[model samples]
Target: MGSPRAASSRSRAITEVCEAKLRMMGGSLRELESGKAAALEEEILRTDAKLEELGQLADAAARDLREDFEQAMELLQSTRRVKEHMLVDHRQQLGDVAERIAALRSVRDEGVKACEAADHAEMVSFLSKHASTYSQECWQLLARPLPRSIQVPLDDIPFEVAKRRDLLRGAQCSEKLARMKNEVLCDIVDALRQERSTHADTREYAVEVESLLEAYATEWEKRFDYACSYCGQVLEAALANEPYCGAMPGRKAHHWVPTDTAGIAEAKETARPQLPVAAASPRLKSQAKIRAISPMFRADSSV
Candidate 1:
């Protein structure tokens, strides 16, 4: 065996070597922990900054969306008011035209009956007395200044010799004018009805769009709230790949699931609004349908 002093010296050298190695390892471990802490702090600051930026962006987006929604609402309201006024005007005009058409038909029918019952002399006298008045009335239906070329004499001729020719001409002019006015009034009625129907369709579509916009605005307003409820701040943080409510560490994201709200259920069940269209008149079907003022002045010689 070696001397005891030599053995003790060897044991001391081994102990010193082990102590040096342990110190080196402890220094390396401290550096690693410090580096990790600094990196974690930097990540936290960066994430907070990102969150602030996202909030600002969301606010700006919400503001723009609200402005657009308000503008759309204003436009819809104004359009609705204008359409209501137009509908009222159309109804009034239609009623006036209907009454006028009925009066014209009644008077024309009476005149036809009178002409059918009259002898030649009575017929001639009747035509002479009423032809100018009837002609003027038909010309007035134009609702504007008449052309100078198509003149209707304001008064009947007093001369007995010229009565037959002038009276016949006046009656013919009255019949032609009446037919033209009738056609015009019928066209107006048809156009008015068609416009009303078109307005109804347009209103229906507008209502549908209005509903959709309202729903969109509602959802947009609640988007942040929904996000908060769904994932809490964990989703906002860069912690988990999937949504989490409370904590991100060691917690699974499989507990909560989205369910349809009452509003969504009601929307699905709701029926779309549809406006009724005006029905077309059978009498005012076509312009070519001849409504003669009298059988005597019938151009096609058909009653």
Candidate 2:
């Protein structure tokens, strides 16, 4: 009985010891789990902080990009407005040139008509003297209204009809005269054409010059509301008022003369009064007085 009781006690003690060991191991495992959980929480907090910082940086970058974009947009808008204004001005200049061309064309047409009439008159005068010499058929052919095709043989035509001695001479003279008249007419036409061409070229050049001036004027106007017509002087409204008389005050005042007010006053003070014209003497005014004086003066004369 005693041996059985000892064995039972020992087994019970062993069982208790095994249970305590298991409990200690379980407690240690629990502590390790808690430590791992704490580490995981800290890692999560770090990740959250990193994400917040990234978000802040991204927001700042976005803000900067937006500001740059806005500035670029504003610059583009300003450039576009300037271009549009220039286009409008150019259109107006072109219209003015067109009107000038139209006027020039009218003048050119009148000149052409005048040249043609002069040529016709010369031809009629030349043909009138030789009217009776040619045959009826030849006269009729000459009279026929033809399109600028009258050709006189300069080197091979008769000079006279009755004797027919030098028939080619008259024809050659007529041809030479006709050629001279044609040359004069052509010169007139060419001169008129050249004048018109020169006028048009001048107009185009002026328009170009005006366009460049207008561009400069626009730029200047944007910077300065009022400017000198002769010089390019830029000033703000406030600064412009500082010296209201001159466009650029620090430099020499153009078109302005310094007047000496003190000298003018002194000159005015020194000026003398103008004298009146002397009247005739009262004794010589009357004829009786003049006769009396003459008699006294003639006492020593014999008469």
Candidate 3:
């Protein structure tokens, strides 16, 4: 064994070395903690930036969708107006033709009865008195030119018969157009709804937008009721103050402007005053004509 003094000096040297190693380890631990904190702060900042960017993107998408929906509604409304006008005009033309036919038929019936009259002198007197009137009527009916669509007689049919065929063709054309308009409008509305559901990030926003659209459509329809005086194409009850016929000459300039739906609730509070109901029109009796036969034939179906 070594002496006591030498042993004590060796012990002091070992203690000093151990203390230095502990100090070095403590310093490394502090550095590691600081580095970790800095890295955590950087991650937090990046996450915040990403969240903000996503929010902005969502807002932009919503705005674009709303604008697109509005444009589609505008197009639908315009198309409805045009098709309604065409249907109204065609109905008027048919009414005029029917009136002329009834007049001609009355004269023919009188002539037929005269042929079978037991009194020959009375029959002759009746024919003589109406001869000039019948001739004038026939001349007037022939003077009117054929419609533009009847470019030539079909299958070499008589001119009068061809005119009647052209009129029938026009009626068929109107029916086809009304059907097509209804289809297009339905497709557009469905597409708008689908797009809204797809792009909206939140359910609440989607419902709100959908409600607004429905309210707008419903309100506009409620305010304007158009029934054609001639064709019986009734969209609804006639507007209390407005003329019922949409196809009346000099009425084309008048149009129904949809009430803005942004403040729909407010609009409902201050609705237009209802006027006293007018007497029912003669056309009201035929309201169940073509529109009743085919629901797709309605101009308002698309709207």
Candidate 4:
């Protein structure tokens, strides 16, 4: 209802009042909003930095674990190879030891068997010879063939009967007996022994016994080869050409010098000083000198 100019003046006054209120509150609100935004931005930057550091630490730990795993795997492989090589070597060594032991046992068994067989055969042959050769059958034949130990006593018995029986026994007839002697059986045994010595088998047996003794001596010599031949001292087996330190009667001296060569004894003898022959007594020498010089000194000393 008022004029146009009056309305305009009232609007201007209202606009000025609103503008003053806006100017008074806008700066404080803007400052509060700007502070809150800056604080949030700073907190976000700090959190991001912490996250980045934690991620870096995690990456470093992962790399360390991966390297350790790789190293562990390589070590396991090397140890496995070493274990395999050791197993093979040990197995081969065990086999060699077993083979050596078996060979030694075989040698021992064969030696024992051979010795037993030889003894048994010899004993059987001995008993067979005694049974067949010296029994009742051969006893009469041995009696009749009086080689040198004549024990028949043909002069004591009736000559005709003795002669007939002797003729029958001598012609290889041993069906019966002719008892006509005293203590003649012992003499017959002696004669039989004499006859046995002439046999070829007994000579062969003697030779065999000699050979057996030689074999035994050879075996013992081989067994004691490491021992000193003169002193019976045990020696080291490791030395291939061990020198003897033993004494000998021919050398006539105990030796520390090894007897590896023949020249040691000759050298000692060459270096030794020869002793002079002993002289006669002083009294005997003076008496001889006086007799050579003259009888005057002897006569004066006597007076």
Stretches of model 1 off by over 4 angstroms after superposition: 1-29, 99-303
Q: What is the Å distance of residue 92 in model 3 from its true position?
A: 2.6
TM-score between model 1 and native: 0.24
1-303, model 2: which lDDT tens digit per residue?
579989999999999999999999999999998989889899999999999999999999999989967876676676667666766676676666566556555555655665678877655554563334435534454465433322333342222233233657778898999999999999999999999999987776555545444553453334223434434454346544443335445664333221344433343453311222224322222333333544422324321
Q: Rank by lDDT, descending? A: 3, 1, 2, 4
Which whole-number lDDT from 0 to 100 does residue 285 have in model 1? 20
For candidate 3, what is the lDDT? 0.63
- The residue-by-residue lDDT of candidate 1 on 180-248, one tens digit each, is 999999999999999999998777655554544455445533421223333444223354355444544
lDDT of 2 at 45: 100
Q: Residues 1-303, candidate 3, lDDT per residue (tens digit)?
A: 999999999999999999999999989989997879789889999999999999999999999988866776676676667666766676678778778878888877877787777778867876787777877877787887543332322343234445668999999999999999999999999999998876664564445444444554564555544444444454433443555346656554334433443333433554422222224332332223322444532333432
State the lDDT at 234 in candidate 3. 47
Pairwise TM-score winner, candidates 2 and 4 = 2
Model 1 CA lDDT for position 21? 99
Compute the lDDT for candidate 2: 0.57
**What digit string (tens of lDDT, one per residue) describes model 4 on residues 152-265?**
322332344456578877754433333323347768888889898767555655554454445535533333234455664545445335453435655432222233333333
User: Model 1 misses residue 5 by how many Å?
Assistant: 31
Clashing residue pairs in candidate 4 are none
Each prediction's TM-score against the native?
0.24, 0.24, 0.25, 0.21
For lDDT, candidate 1 versus 4, the one ahead is 1
lDDT computed for candidate 4: 0.55
Give the least accurate 10-residue stretch of model 3, judged by summed lDDT: 273-282
